[model samples]
Target: MPANLHAILSASSAERWLNCTAAPRYEEQFPETTSEYAEEGRLTHSICELKVLKKFTTAINQRTYTNRLNKLKKDTRYAEEMERTSDIYLEHLTEKAMGYDAPPLVNAEVKVDLTDYIPEGFGTCDCVMIGGDTLDITDYKHGKGVPVSAVNNPQMRLYALGALIKYEPFYGGMIKNVRTTIIQPRAMSEDDRITSETLSVAELKAWGESIKPIAQKAYSGFGEFKSGEHCRFCRGRAQCRARSETYTALEDFKDALLPTPENLAQVEQDGQDGIPTPAVLTNAEIGDLLTRGKSILAWYNDLENYALGAVLKGEDIPGWKAVAGRSNRTFTDQDAALASVIASGYDEALVYERKPKTLTALESLMGKKEFAEKIGAFIIKPPGKPTLAPASDKREPYNTATADFTGVTQEVLF
Candidate 1:
């Protein structure tokens, strides 16, 4: 097999590259790195692939499957969670396959090419299914930090387009509709685990045409620099000049509001504390500030991290130096320390604090179905605290009246 080389305009990073066309070239300065989370996700994907091959196709025999699975389980990073989550993923695939009137064509770990639209663009689709007229492309997201939506998701749509191109010759262009799905089994809530969106073949092709120019610009390293939430995963996000300028735009707002001498003189004294206070910001100003303020904290943290990393590497940064951060003390040998405490006339139970497993932990320990069946009635989800979000946020607005009535008593009056 040929070595897997990432495309400059790969489908996975399409969102970032499409939005900030200059990101792909800028990110080349940073070295590639992987985290434990990424390693675990890779292992999980391997497991899912093996399960799909064994169940959906005749690619592997029983003995081979068992041997491969056991070897994977022996890896240090492997955990029972991987097995349980992969099982759920397999069940989902089984159900999807069964839903078709006839057994649909299923494939796992499919490599699709998109050179026609994007220059050398390619990606690995986790699962692909083709029934009579619909082609389904499903991606397994192992991370649990955020829920991914399939609606107008660029990555998934790109993958769908690539899959269509790859299967065109075999299917003779019989595919009419395309379905893109994201499965995040470890999501915080069960309802959010799966999300799917369907588009007709014409629509998917139209979207591909829409991005062809952007893709060419991105591939040629001749695109404009833009920044937004898409910068989160870019390798050079911390050092990107466009991002720095975007966040620092907040500095201009201060000049917009200048306290005139007359307004300063009109400053009112607090009746209770007798402290002079400047004129309060208008509601419109507050809204404007909030719009810019949303990204300031994240940008500040990224800048601080970049500076600290540079300083640690012997680079001199004016007014900034790396110092040892505070850390908590821990017993070098916890078991030995606990034993010593027990021998010093202290009860062994006092040295340890007992607590029940959290609902999430319990659900992981026992499978989700078993946990629900055993103690479903005991579980409850209280209303979440009110949080500020932009108008584009999907969640419904919180009701102040309902919030005030919660945990408070109301007396009936005649």
Candidate 2:
């Protein structure tokens, strides 16, 4: 298998390395491993590109599109959910393209070269559309675990900069603004599924200028090692000395002021006397503790994984040992087991229960257009329960008073 290669200053990790400038060099020691999730993302991206190309270009034949999709089906990760999500991505692009007065120039899998800002910097753009004075860059995100926003996103801005550089000669003076969009159909909240940010040409150019030095410093491995939430995806996170020192320092600080049972008792006694307890942390101190708590948790998880790996390899890790985890019993041969069960006594109907195909599966089997035309009216989506999210989330805040309770009724027992 070929090794998955990454650019030294790739747009995807701009958020990480830009913040923790020394992470790239630190991460260089570890080999890159492609997870099943990464492969699924690759497959979904390919599907999205092919679908977009088919819709935009007249030269592509139906057979070509079918062949591409058929090949994707061979991947174990391929599923109806992927097709549905990719369709939503394509729909977003199509809608954006249609809004233009003239037919927009839509390109998929666009190669963006960003050497001007970072050394040998380059990345592939999912979709790019240009018409009149506006350029739209849309990125398809397959992962639904975390919601991504386009506002001040380094990756998207870097893409916009590269796109600007690539098309400036052709669309100079005509392209005034760049719109960067992230389409994550699997996002939990409907509003969070699609988010956009628009930046003027002047703003993009200024941002490019600001990051030029930072990129150069990062390339030369001559920058400070600052740890933050960006460390979540860093390969060096487990062993990075800077990150270790950061967590260790914070832990020491926390230990000094952390409330204990004794301190709580003293605090309660002080409160009874109507005196403020000095043991309580200030607002700033509490905030700092909370921030460090997240880093500590992440570091602990990394340490646990490292220890587990060490133990598995017969390496001694002082206080830890690997052991067999719980496993559930399963039939060795499901088909034979089912057959034996049927022959003995159990009815086939009792053994297996039939279930209808999911909406996404049905749509994938039948063409999305035909499925919508025929069964669209049968679909009804109820409002989802409200959940807490960051203020930055695009979702509107749920209003308790405005919620419908028509179906709910009160009951009384005699």
Candidate 3:
């Protein structure tokens, strides 16, 4: 899924629906700037799942449960404000956070794959508590503030789809009364939010139909490339010509005009009450005009960080306090751990080296090693000066291939 222009710009659900349907192009586009910790949250989710599934199937607690309230608290390298929300999820999973129909769990594996058609897609959900036919799919949101509902969450719906497919053979009946839920760990905050929604059978079928063309197009050719907001996650973000031009066009026309809502009548005897004003403009000028009217904080870019630096000890000379930065501890250092191992009193060397450094090193690594994983350039199909790299090539990621590409279907992830 590298820089194939078609893959880069066309990955969004909206983009998929828009390209096939008669939906008119919006003058504006959204770019999904997914965060680093969001990526880490995904990784942690995978790790947690490995542990949970191992435990669920083997009926033994494999992963050592730690006193650390959250994962990052136990392992400090990944802690940033970006990870604070993930920590919240950890707390929720470990039963340190709050209320749950069942004890809070982390990375509780739930999957959904719309396999009814070709190029079928599947997503593993973050967490959930099984409650009969009502399977609550709680996707972790590392963003700050109150948890948002997973209601109508595409990922959750997809998870439900996967669950249905999985359970059909085992449960053998219609898999009636399946439901989903989303759990946000943090208490209500200005920035942290979680939302959930349930999907009707009609809705899921409709969604399947809606995404059919996108999957098909992704499989068939890189042609029909278009640009819009969702391209923020595009691996070719820095150099996508279509994305650049689309954003540039929107910015250029930012001051065009907007159709404003007009007030119908004047204020009555009420002193404070006033009549609403009606002004009209297009999407362009509306931004400027609306900026002057109210103090609506649509995007809270500032809530990106929360951790404050602790006092620096003996290291700093000026305007600094004498204290160590907030840090974490490990169970390996505990006398109790040593005593427990001694009590079991078996081979000390094997017990001591149970978790070798190499194993932990691999666990701590970032990203997949595949070269073909890089963000690729976006372009239309029937590639012109196309990079001739093999589809299975793992040397470079995305469309980062040095070979020049022309529009072609092979450029995308089928």
Candidate 4:
């Protein structure tokens, strides 16, 4: 086995590095750190890979699965939720594989090389299955905060490009189309949980050619700095001068467009009759401001974190200083407190009310197959609330008229 190579323009960071060419080099100054959520994701991915491998290769046994899971469960963040979610991801792959006329060639944790399209670009596809004329690549997302879609997703496209390059020699002309799927088990709704996009080999290759120059420029650290939603996860976002300048421009532009003193006086006088003139903005100005607003808040948050971190480390931040946040009271000894409360003629139920296990926990306890067979019909999933997202996001526009509502209404009596 060989050690995995880290690419300067990794496929996972393609959206960020490709857009902000200076990000890769700038981000290199910061040390890589993983969060508890990231660790949980890694553990879940390991379980998914093992389960898939065991399906094809019998060398892996139940004991191997149990040992790996037992080790993962030792981590404080690990829970039955991970196992349930992993089962959903694995079941999706199995279902997709069964749809093929012939048995599909399934590969898990497959290394993909995208150096052809991006400079040293590479990533591991969670699941890749080839059958007849289709190559399906699936990526697992463990995060529940945001729903991921496969339509026009650069990461999946890059992975597909890499897979095509590696497997083309073996499959040749038999592979006509590539299908990319994103399985986000924690998505709010079932429909949003799975998203797939298909493209012909010619289309995918053309896209690869389109990004070659951008990747090369990023590789040489010679492209202009650009920022957008992609900066959300960029390590150098807080220190990026270009992003700061972009945000500053918004304020400067707004100040320059402020109404004159005479106009303000005229509006005040005109509003004496209870009708005031409304401030009007041109469509172009509105669009520009809207675009800037989307990123300004995120940039401000990043700046706050950076400044606070520096202040906490005893680094001078000019006018800022770290202060202890407000704290809440907690029991000094929970078990002893509970025992004393029970001894004082209080019922145990008053101290602790037992609740039913969550749907995920119950499913994990009873086994997904058995649970579904017995009580799947009781599951009811409500539609998710509409949220504002960038136009580039793949989610469909939410229609307000189609929203479901309960007939019962309560009137507030003030």
Candidate 5:
């Protein structure tokens, strides 16, 4: 309900909003806007605009609701909006905003559920012009960061999927003949900066299908990756097993470190300067060591409040956060314990732990030096897929009608 909040509304949601049809199997417990990609802004804006135009006696666009503008960069502002919906909302509000309003409920969160597996995939466009073949889907973004292009954005594509899914059922399979774009209202200080791009029905479908596998994999790995970045804002982050690793990484490094500024500086300098290997350590090895530590630290920092916290009244408060990490916190008392064991005449070999085999040894196991030049040393593995994608442009293709700005865009073909 507030502006600048990053609610996760996705394509599945867009489909449900426009159709005015909530799915029977669909049970959304959180606020309607809590979805990863939501479409509520459009609904709110549409209603506000309608009220302003219909009430001739109303001197002010008595928009009863307000929204908190988005704070993050690359929120829904882009070019195409100026070409279409900008005029519509502006005319409706007939107002100049001071800051963002949070109470005004709208269909701003629009997503195309390319994956039919999710029920919210079925969606209606934000605004529809009646008595014509033209269909325009308008979306609003409140964030303050750089406006990302709606073209090739998965969020927009998912919204597209929802549009097609909802519209095609009644209009028949041909869901084409249109333009799509992001309309950033504040960008130009006039209307929205619109990205004038067109998407074929076929292309939209293809893009939607392309992302289905990715979504499926995430759903599958939800358990394994539950604790890391996923846990940061996850609805179920508190009890996830994957998040447990985040805790482990954090705990391992939360040592009461004795800061050795000089020692650390020398080690880091040696690594960067590429000092030759001495009997003790080499610069190259130092760099590698630093990198490994960074990697481990990153994994450890993935844990949120549970692993990193600053308490006031023995309770955690929002905003004032803390950082913690995982590092090998060896028990110093171990030397004393070891000495007692030696006193008992235990073999030194019994005290030693087995070390993991070096990667070079694994390579040697896979290849023989006899024909090492000709044999493959090791099989390569690709890195994992990235987690996040950009926000979507919530626009559908429509012929640029220099038509009456006063004309309606939503038409009931039915």
Candidate 6:
């Protein structure tokens, strides 16, 4: 669906504004930016809408569907993965509809209103299904990083609320249940890629009530300024004092390591550890710092990028300025350059280097199914390098003891 207008309190960004309260107003100064990934997602979503309309409804004739699909396929960003992923999403919708006794009323890319709760909030639901006492809302995510959960997800919940409001007149308060589903085919595992959670109408309404005050505060732009994981997508994150304070507060944990005058004097003689502070940290300190490690890195990079952009625009910062970095030379015409190199007494082999395509590239070249059918058996996957992660991460704990001896034998070593 083409969205030419957006509400100030859009349902899609509810989580950010709901948490930060001041993000919506603060973000107004920054223009929205798009990336190749976002463009690809929009293309994939268009494909999904077309798929649903063709499969479930009689609105589109075969000829129209074909022509529309053909036009979409011609987009430069279109890839086999888009088709494959959209099919996965369609299959999930089909399975859900089939589980019901009779065909459920389905709507694709339906525009929904949330003005009953939030101030002028409206959004487009990817798919909505109404049957008996239940309403199902499915959101398709094209991201590959974290697998979004349907449980307590504010975006999904808000969409569900908007959906209920959109169909309330027709259902006449008979709809008692709401189910929100997130279909992320690009997630790492099959089991976690698609997830669903059910909520009663009362529960959903209660949640809406809980956020009404916060929504009002956000709309008025007079609420508290707080920072957390939700700050990732906020345009003001780079300069927000609250977010900067959140990371700088970590310095308080280092009070124990503060250097004394005598300790600093010892460092004057030789660069060695001082006497006042212990060289090692306790497990508690490690645990405390580890919690903010990922956020610190992300915040640091965002700040750096912002500073670079500011400097390039001729803004002055004390002791800081942007300068040209190193650049590598490249041939304007690679084929001609290579041909010249070969003709100039250089062997053809010396002028060119050959490398095999990566597995991902090959998979994209030959659609996923064909790639698996042709050479899946020949592929081997090695264990990944160990890295630190939080306890709440979905991946299993790494076992250093087993990993050390799994492929080693004493006889071979001897």
Ranking of all candidate structures by their TM-score, best first: 1, 4, 2, 6, 3, 5
Lowest lDDT 10-residue stretch of candidate 4: 405-414
- lDDT by residue (114-221, candidate 1, tens digit) is 887888778889999999889999888898977777887999998998899889778986899999988899987565688899999999999999999999898788
* Backbone clashes counted, model 3: 72
Candidate-wise lDDT, in order? 0.84, 0.83, 0.44, 0.82, 0.41, 0.84
- Displacement of residue 105 (Cα, Å) in model 1 is 2.5
lDDT comparing candidate 4 with the true structure: 0.82
lDDT of 6 by residue, 262-323 (tens): 56776776777644454766565577667767788989998998899899998977788898
**Per-prediction TM-score, please?**
0.85, 0.82, 0.45, 0.84, 0.36, 0.78
| Candidate 5: stretches off by over 4 Å | 1-9, 12-124, 128-135, 146-148, 169-174, 187-193, 220-414
lDDT by residue (1-414, candidate 2, tens digit) is 113347787899999888988887778888887788889999999999899999997747899889978998888888878878888898888888889999999999888888888887898789999997998899999888888888889999999988888888988699999999999988876677899999999998899899888888887887789988898888877877888888777547645355545556887867754323464576555665666576689898998887898789999999889989999999999999999999999999998889999886787788778999999987756556877543545667876654554223211211
Q: How well is each residue in 134-171 modelled by candidate 3, as lDDT tens digits?
A: 44455665434324445545556666666666555755
Q: How much does candidate 5 score in TM-score?
A: 0.36
User: Which residue window of length 10 is worst by lDDT in model 6?
Assistant: 405-414
Cα RMSD for candidates in order: 5.8, 5.2, 22.9, 5.3, 27.6, 6.2
Clashes of each: 0, 0, 72, 0, 71, 0
CA displacement after TM-score superposition, residue 210 of candidate 2 (Å): 1.6
Q: Candidate 1 at residue 192, lDDT?
A: 67
Candidate 1 Cα errors over 4 Å, as ranges: 1-4, 188-192, 254-278, 343-345, 401-414
Which whole-number lDDT from 0 to 100 does residue 330 have in model 1?
Answer: 90
Highest TM-score model number: 1
Q: How close to the true structure is residue 70 of candidate 5, measured as C-alpha lDDT? A: 20
